[model samples]
Target: MRVVLVSLLVVSVTCLPQGAPPTVCQTLMPFHGGGISPQGGIPPYSIIPRRQGGRVAITVTSSLGIPFQGFLLQGRTPRREILGEFDQTTTQDGHTIQCGEPADSLTHNNPGEKNSLDVIWTPPDGYEGPIVFNATIAQSYDTFWVGVESPPVDISRRSVINDPSFNIPRQPPTTTPHYARPIAKQSSTEFDPFYSGCAVTKLCFGAPDNCVINKSCKSAVAVTVSGDRYEFELKADNAAWVGVGLSDDDKMGDDSVIECVTRNNRVDAYMSWTSGPPNSYGAARLSNPQLGIQLLNGSVVDGVLYCKIRRDAYTNVNGKVFDLINEKYNLLIASGSSATASSVSFHDLSFLASAQKQSLSDVSALAAASKLLVRLHGCFMLAAWLGTASVGILLARYYRQTWVGNQLCGKDMWFAWHRTFMILTWALTTVAFVLIFVELKAWSAEKNPHAILGTVTTILCFIQPIGAYFRPHPGTSTRPVFNWLHWLIGNSAHIIAIVTLFFAVRLTKAELPDFVDWILVAYVVVHVISHLVLSVLNCTAEKSSERRVTSFPMKDLGASGRNSGYNDRSPDAPFSNVRKGLLAVYILIIIAIVIALIVITALAPIEETWTTLKSTVMDNN
Candidate 1:
């Protein structure tokens, strides 16, 4: 019986079908797992499983408009040493290459077209069972200033060829393999072929011959003139609304804008209008209905959001679009956080105007000139003139006489300090005027309020030093005329400086952060109070001198002067009781103003409040 049983078992094993092994259906199952997505990525990761030699295709699409720039796919097998994959991703030029090891590492240069990258993965040969595949999607974050990897998304899938019973078809060569394209350098004389539309005749992105003149835009943009249409690429560092506006004037108002806003990992395209003000975007979603504006694609990768916008060179979309042909106009670029997309509170704004076709040399010269102008104007207005002049005035008015009667280097401390401050102010004013001339390139006045005020202030300031040089000797008959001229010119210039500063603050309120208004207001209050105190002191001193002079009898002038100590110019002529009381009041007012400023600055919603001010008064009314 045992011999018969063994013989029957052997026959049964040998009789099994020789064409195919037993099927392990468990090795071929649908992808079923939790809702885990790669780090920094939104979900719905499409993973297609294949039976042939354990191959799988992984595709990740952003739920938001954010484009996928790069990704890392890792396969962990039961046997670590056996882990292997042959991967591929298409480039901008439609060429594909081996994505090796950590998969798609080299393809970072070619970001996905519309926020998606197809990753082909093949597990190691001869290894079967189940393999866990994990991925980390990479894209730009925080204004495209930084790149971050998404958290690992892990899922397990069965291998197809693990059982010989299942047929594993060969994965057809989906794409032809090609060598990687080299990055092209921008050359002034030659246009690089890296850009699609930017041929010799049509300038594209990355081409030096691209005729677009960049003025104040903050993004990496490339604009080209192609026949009846103008094509452009706008790139920024983070996920937000980035756009370009075309205007007949340099101002942002009355312009048509092409915009892309990235949110929830998807980018939305729009055609917007600046019909009224910067805050009023007048945005409308652009879909199949063409208004001469077209969005080729939008993608976000490595913290950068890239949007390709196209429009006819000339269009009459009810005056919504400007002509971009041979005419001169202004091109502006602006970006806002997602929260301010509707309001268009762009944190970044850049502009260039008087744009026309230019030669390479002309473009280079213009670029250098623009840069120099920006730096010079910025330094003069923000630091040199505004900052130094304000400081000098404050020091001369407040600190100069704070140590009255105190001597330094055998000179009156007040006089020495005041002279030093005034000299500094004069030098700063000269430099500021030179910078303004250099920036503007001409002496045309009344162009704007800022220019007019600046010109007047500069003229008044120049007269001060000349008047000082012509000052008459003390006690001379001409001294009173000199005094009056000096006082009138000095006070007039000072008042103009204050007004100019106010106008400057108003003009640049949009550029400044919210808290700057509080700072400016505080300084203005302090400055006015200090000037009042100085005026009152001068009046009181004049009254005291008159009293002393009238009280003296002409016949007994020497005795009266000696008794009243009027001839002394020493430290003993310290502030009187009334002057001391005035000083106390001045100090109290300054302290109170400073405290109030601090409180207001701390509590105010600077940007919002600033917007309200503009809308209520400066902008609308």
Candidate 2:
């Protein structure tokens, strides 16, 4: 059995008002397992004296069972590797009891043998602020900042037997620049004393872009009172962000739906908006995560917009133990006036508490990471296209020469390359989507639902290979669907390719390659015209002629099914040549669309698009 000792101490909570934990800790659970205390839990740690050079050690022993089984000491305070993981099952009075792990990080952790800890708090050069400490049981812990409470100083009222001051070096912690405090970077931009929807396009406590501008919202951050919901903006700095869109339609699911915006892939911090749907202004990101005197969890609070920070979404892996992740947040308010207020209130708060102050001073880290993913994803589409196209065009030539599955068709090395390429393409494409999505929202398939149109296109892309691998001898009409699906997916790939290209051009205007756009456009047009002429030739040549022309395995067909069986053909019937030429024309038109998209994305800012879309919608109303 375990012994229990409780002590009550009074404390004040000036920050917490009603419903706060009682002003006194009525139960002081001492760290005792056998007769000795175990090392764990909330502050007031039994600070051991420095043994060698700035290292403090504490011993943990238990007669009944081990404390903190599988354990490791982490974080910046007293970094220590995991001593070891223990699966200690101790028998108490002949009953086997599984005692849990050590948790200097959170409560309910059992420390095994050598439960003692060696901690070293090297405050930056002569620093003296109470080094803050927080423990997260595991990943699912409520992401909240833990407030530092000072340890009782005087011994007259029966402070423990150990001399408290001995724990802290007598040298007096003093420093030039305190690590606890961050020197604010004075921004060069000045806030407009008078707010106008048009003038103040971009906003926030940090660097931001221009907001939408119109009658209702002359700027991206402003909004006019509407018959329905209000609009607002929220931003996150140094963290992954998720937007909570509020809606009245219960059918859509919740009153609020969270849209994940940023990711923690780049480390530092992630942020997202806790923005309710259409409250005032359509939400927007205002700044990147950075150090601030006051932490706002993950939100931006500027009186006009109140964004409170909270913990990142997580899953629990153990009992009562949760790991917390750092996130940033910002809020955009579209009130009638640009008046700021301080009346923000919230219940049940949690956040990833940081005991140290740091900044993402490692320049080029995020940009480089995002750029790498973009390039990687671009390569996936490129590989799929090049791989399939080579086989298709080559087999098309061979088919015209051989009589539909002639002996010489499958006698070459082409079929091997075709299948290999298809397999590789699938893997690459999947990886590309996952990696890019995890880094940033740029070129995201999720942000725009229209992007899935590419999926249908990719399907037709590899279908030919499978059919070729199956029979190597598909009827004329049977091969056409393969051709058609290939065409569709190829076109979709072209669209997605253009988008990724546009992103590259927009980000690195000087480094963009010119040949990509030109080659893509020219090839599209040429292919369409060529397709028409070929269709006509096949038709006029007669059915016997079409049947005679089958070379190679139709090697590129990856997916196939038969219906009246003339393999999926791409021939334009009726006007044949005219239709083919018109298809060429369509290709040219879309090329123009691609250019328009690129120009708008690169030259014109989104603040303008928001305004245009808003105004056009308004005028129609």
Candidate 3:
């Protein structure tokens, strides 16, 4: 008999606490209304409230497997009259409530496959008004903020507390330690049950509310009213760190990031702030370590990394703070190789439309500006390279003597027209060059072939004018050398400039429709045909010059009342078959250029055009 007594004493010392367990009131019957039936879970079972002494007891219940996270009970009798604050023991599914705080919130310490909680709230001394309870719970994977309000309970019925039917079963002796999880002290970095992490080894709960999945990543987000914190869960298709952030301006700059990374086979979490795009992530700094950025859980499935993170919407940390309660926020998700790295280090990113609306007004403005610049640049390029330059070259090469009798500005007529057209072309081309720089702020030559070619052509054009200014006099002994250099540089520059113009057309096609290409094609055809006509006329004059030198000597030139050159002309002058053949050849060349233009524009490869257009759009984005 003494041995049995000793065994009982030893068991009691090992199991029971030295002090009495916290006491809580029993919940009363007569729940208010029918519970709400939500997706993926049954309706709330019952919400019973009872009073014992100074504390009020409220029990919330739901079916098994319902993902209920927490609840909020607010007094509604006379509005904020006699607030009930949680401070004592609460029970849920035979486990003690772990996440309760000093506020009107009751958060479970551990998540259970089933949902139920018994909470104790203290009312003011001598308070007599009826109290109302407003409860909110996280339904399945933090998917939705489900809520319900209880009818007012009149405290005048004193028998509700003494009735045997309303009595709660006595709590069993404590076998596990229960620690107070006060919110004001939750800033600790050590692991705590209140904000303990969670991981998804498999797709648990089978497609939670507001879940979005693609080939690269899957994600879902939920928020709660306790300091307005957000809980994020992401499953990336690749093994990489996943992150989610909130932005006030829908941009990476001035945003807060919560990330989870797997390094050396160990999963870790980080919080950071950004001031630039993802590529500039090196500038992003780590957030305050005490700011309560917790990685609740993480796992790997089929080479994909899944992570769950929680953080408050507002904090006093040394980073961008998001006011999730008062202001609308934009949510962004990204994946990267390095957990500690900045957002720029990530390879893939997604923006959720539900979090915040994206404004395209700025993008539209930029696109409109780019379109205007491209069209203006294309026009200036065509006018200068094909119209002015082409005409000037042909006139100087073939019609120099033809215009001698009709001089302008104290020079040959063709030279005067050439100078005027070139001046106008130079002015317009320079304007276009400046406009391009304005449109493309960085003037990225590597990305824009048109900008690079334009710069080269502009340089060549600039040097040609400088070279012309230093030309020797026409009658000097060095005049021949000067003319050769002048003509070589001038013609080469024109040819290169024109080639650059062709690429400009291709660039324009990227931004504009195919009809713009047709317009350019027609313009080119007309210019080429005009050049051929000049060539034919030049060849015919050369033949006529030879006849003059052979048919009449320089001694007899003065008697014919004409210059010794081929200026002499009459209706009876002999016409060569070679000249007529050259004219016929020129006509055929013109017809061929026209037909080629028609065929090329009509049958332009749709695939190639589409590829180019897609490239343009991607680059712009």
Please name the candidate that would achieve the greatest lDDT relative to the true structure.
Answer: 3
Q: Model 1, range 185-262, lDDT digits (tens) per residue?
A: 222212111122223233322101122321112343456554565766676555376776666654446666777778
Q: List the residue pairs that clash in candidate 3.
A: 98-109, 197-296, 198-296, 198-297, 278-344, 279-344
lDDT-superior candidate, 2 or 3: 3
- Model 3 RMSD to the real structure? 19.5
lDDT of 2 at 399: 29
lDDT of 2: 0.29
> Whole-model Cα lDDT per candidate?
0.45, 0.29, 0.46
Please give the RMSD to the true structure for each candidate, in Å. Answer: 18.6, 24.9, 19.5
Give the TM-scores of the predictions, in the order they appear.
0.39, 0.29, 0.37
Q: Write model 3 residue lDDT over 179-216, tens digit each, in one string.
A: 32211211221211111111211111101112221111
TM-score sort, best first: 1, 3, 2
- In candidate 2, which residue ranges exceed 4 Å CA deviation? 1-357, 360-368, 390-394, 397-399, 402-434, 437-447, 458-519, 533-621
